[model samples]
Target chain A: MPNTLILSIDAMGGDHGPSVVIPAVDIAARQLGDVRFLLHGDQAQIEAELAKAPAARAASEIRHADKAIAMDEKPAQAMRRGKGSSVWNAVEAVKDGQAAAAVSAGNTGALMAISMLVLRMAEGIKRPAIVASWPTMNGISAVLDVGANVESDAEQLVEFAIMGAAFHHAVHGSTKPTVGLLNVGSEEQKGHEEVREAHALLRANSFDFDYRGFVEGNDIAKGTVDVIVTDGFTGNVALKTAEGLARFFGNELRATFKSGPLAMLGAVFASGALGAMRKRMDPGAVNGGPLLGLNGIVVKSHGGADAPGYAAAIRVAADLARSDFTAEIDRNIRRLGAVVSESAASPAEGAAE
Target chain B: MPNTLILSIDAMGGDHGPSVVIPAVDIAARQLGDVRFLLHGDQAQIEAELAKAPAARAASEIRHADKAIAMDEKPAQAMRRGKGSSVWNAVEAVKDGQAAAAVSAGNTGALMAISMLVLRMAEGIKRPAIVASWPTMNGISAVLDVGANVESDAEQLVEFAIMGAAFHHAVHGSTKPTVGLLNVGSEEQKGHEEVREAHALLRANSFDFDYRGFVEGNDIAKGTVDVIVTDGFTGNVALKTAEGLARFFGNELRATFKSGPLAMLGAVFASGALGAMRKRMDPGAVNGGPLLGLNGIVVKSHGGADAPGYAAAIRVAADLARSDFTAEIDRNIRRLGAVVSESAASPAEGAAE
Candidate 1:
């Protein structure tokens, strides 16, 4: 077998912590034999949870970190202050090449800050974006910059589109992902000046991926497009809205079954089908979102995620490691750089700093 | 009981036209006994549908219009060219004092354009905003300028917040509505430069209703606050995203219950609860969005709405008319203008034109 895909997990993160993370990691390791985990957190808490799974303990190793990052702390300040935090330590493993990837269910802002501060952006990346895959009717559609960079210009949006397309292809195994800019309307000249200018830039580029015009808010869940690109502000709103609606729908479904006898009977008959649908729509199944365009692999799990959710996140990290996504992204970046350099007078090389 | 709330219905505006509009009018006229409708559209088509509803025919009146506006035409160009269109006639009825309010499930852009052109803004109002209500767990929250004025400055956003607050109170029956500025974060000092300045402006005028500081995307549907305010671009995205999720949730629920026999049984038992849930989440029940701050009453319905949905729009328009929303809005506008005048010098009286 190829060398094990080592994933560094921030066990102290999330509401459930090692109680959920330990079981989830055990389940994932058992299912994917080639995967091993470096659990980073307080050694005592992690060991107490892992004690239940002696076999998993033998399969995985623990890397203790004394401190943990609080969710509400300012991302930049916390990264500077929490030098020994589990999130920081987990990311450090990837930066030092101790692990192929890192997974955290801690503060998203902190994760993004530490990832950027430590591993830095990959070659040709103007800014790193957070990309999440949401389950859709057709399959799954990937939305980028959900909350990474809140304020982005037209160039950054275009770059996000390119990165999103590449990430979708790399992770989902799609040949030519159909990328679209999320907007109020699908017309050629809709949306604000940023979107309008970004549309022009994206259209002019000769990327191998298919730029499938613009998509509306409703199109994301319908799975109409494979990759949806937007500024972090809009993208974050769309993602959160989707999550909120899913919760609302789940509550509504539960309420529907409890109304009366006839309805209760109807629900009984629909339990199996409903269960399947629930599984498909389960956020846990689509738990992890890769922090794309980073130098090292880092995945951010939902803050409220449980053991099964953490396990799924580990699976996503392992899959990225196995697929050589970073290498592919690096190659595309260089290709993009060459194209950009030839067409336009390349901006001064040191412009990013 | 009270003077019937007169609502002019553009019977020829929607995709289905009189086929949907007439039946919906009839339903509203019967359900809401203290309401009357003036249906304006193709004489023959509307008459044909109205003939089917004997009771509604007796209650509601029809005013014929020779032409209808197509969805694809430019809003201004169409309104200018198609002077005798149903939308125009309906607005004319409202302006002429023959109808208390005008409601249309027509081309949204056309409706807004014509409403602004014909009715104009209220005397002290700078711009007319299209305000829509988002259904939330707490109740309902109003988001303004879904697509009224695309590019807005700090002053305009402050104006929107003021107008949106009045609207929530007038229509939603919200007392002391908590008005929030929709930003990327809840901090008073966050968001783009324009939003940041607007936040300061709103904070300075603390006497103007209950200003609840800032809110984010997730808060819109949670109904954390009563009135959520944002510029047209962000507001449009939030409104559309919420609508899309509602539809997606419905479809997912249906698919989940219909998968197999056991699932079917489960759905049967859950049917009553589901119906109650669906009732609460139904878009048709919350169909109309008033074009607030206009000199005359105008309500816009969703493009894809059906008869039942159209009926709800009529009810909303009637409710607004009966509640003296215009008078309430006018009072607040004057109050706000007085406060603004005191804080800063009045902007040369007629800066709006």
Candidate 2:
């Protein structure tokens, strides 16, 4: 008998809460066989949504949480009053070995806070970074440190690259996945000193992934590397900007077609082609990205993700949990700590103060 | 006689040298009626290219230079050996009051270096910033500090906002262009201290542009503001990322349409609409953007730009020269300096060391 991969769900987290989560859980279960869910939230509301998703209802064992964390609450506030909340309880399930992984589309700060507090950090990893599944010309590449650390030093950046590489290997099944440090310019002399230090360290440290040195902003979409690493601040801006540009490009293209009667005629004939393009660019297709370097796998969906998009997130979480992803990352990070023993000096070098 | 706007041209700059620059000058001369050029380069080579453009020859007077800066040359190298080089001489023309603006497709770092040395910094501006005229959903908006300085304090960011607003007003003809600080998050508590301090300063200062506070990367394409300001490090990465994403999006869409016979037929019908979009999204359509916060105007074209794109750069140089853009920026930056009186305390607050 195949081992059952169980994922905990924070059904009360996202904008739509249980409504989106229940259907997503059903879709994920259908896509990924041999899976069970430990759902944490308001029992009555979850059961109502689960009633509509018969598959999810059968696979999930619902647990009642008396309260839900508000989206606006800070990390400190969540730590103070968020125990027994859906997200907190869900994370605790993972820590308690009742669930293999946790998935949330809730308040990012609150989620990160509660997860770190409950699950604890991976033994060797200093800070965990959020990952983004970026759409590339060839396929998809994982970009991380999206917003976990607003500021990162060389060591943290190096750790992000390590975690990203491990996650990519787990998700994409690439043995020697290539990694690159994202910079303003590809030249060795370009960018801040810490970026240079990270580049040097990755090159010299005999890292797990194929370190492709420096890559620029354009490299992110070109799929120049399998995993791109940067500080959370730059990564967040890049991820959101790319999202904005793709939408902007599509809107502008549609407007061009609607400009005249001749264009309208062309639109009808080309509806098949345009439809294919639309499907390829759909956010729902690649909505779920793992938050790597954590003790347990946690996938985050876009805040406004619908059922289909949330399903994509759940699929990622379930897939990661099933694989030996946690053990793989833990082993790699431990090896990384031994190889780059200079992690002690790096934080001081990159600190702004 | 309409007052002629004299633009100093570095004819030896860019990949194609005089071949691209001479024809571009001709196009600009025709596009803007009251324009004359002070072309700087090897006389024989420039005149040979000028022979193909009768209109350009009529409008230009060749001024020979003995040296030329290589594309890969560093800024420090340019300062030492670039004197009397085409780019250097071109900037000298602006400083000597022979031309109102200088246009180059030369090395970005070298161009800024030579321009700064000759033109000097404008009063009350610590560093000059490269401006990019971004194509938005509504119209063009200006984003600045693209790559002049890798790190900037709150005062420099405020200065960029002031200069960006002036450029927007000069080009877009908006009396009070709205400005936003590019950040990872829009909330008050997000981002680094410099960003928060910059946010506080922009709100408190009586800036010429309407301050829109913090904006995320998505707001750039959303056209949330007329001017977007950030430290050069973030701005450069954001600008390049947007450009990269646009191309990636276009490439992916093309592949989608070419997937199968049905898609091909649909593509054939939608050719007209697609053609219209192709035209609207062409990089050549929006090529030139001013390098703001300088003593005199300087416009940098895409290094690989063909004749049409180079012509677009020349047009921008001529337009800014005639619009009193420098005086406007100078005046606004001066006012900005007076309004934000705490520049002394900012760098120390932001420094890591």
Give the top-scoring candidate (DockQ): 2
Over B141-175, each residue of candidate 1 has an lDDT whose tens digit, in order, gives 88777877655777777778877877777778887
Fnat measured on candidate 1: 0.57
Model 1 misplaced regions, further than 4 Å: A272-276, A282-285, A334-353, B1-5, B31-37, B50-62, B149-151, B269-276, B283-285, B334-353
RMSD of each: 5.4, 3.1
Cα error of candidate 2 at position B302, Å: 1.2
lDDT of 1 by residue, A150-187 (tens): 66776777778777777787678788889888776777
Give Cα distance to truth, residue B172, candidate 2, Å: 2.4
Clashing pairs in 2: A352-B351, A352-B352, A353-B352, A353-B353
Candidate 2 chain A weakest ten by summed lDDT? A344-353
DockQ values of all predictions: 0.38, 0.51
The lDDT per prediction is 0.77, 0.81
| Segments in model 2 whose C-alpha atoms lie over 4 Å from true places | A282-285, A339-353, B282-285, B340-353
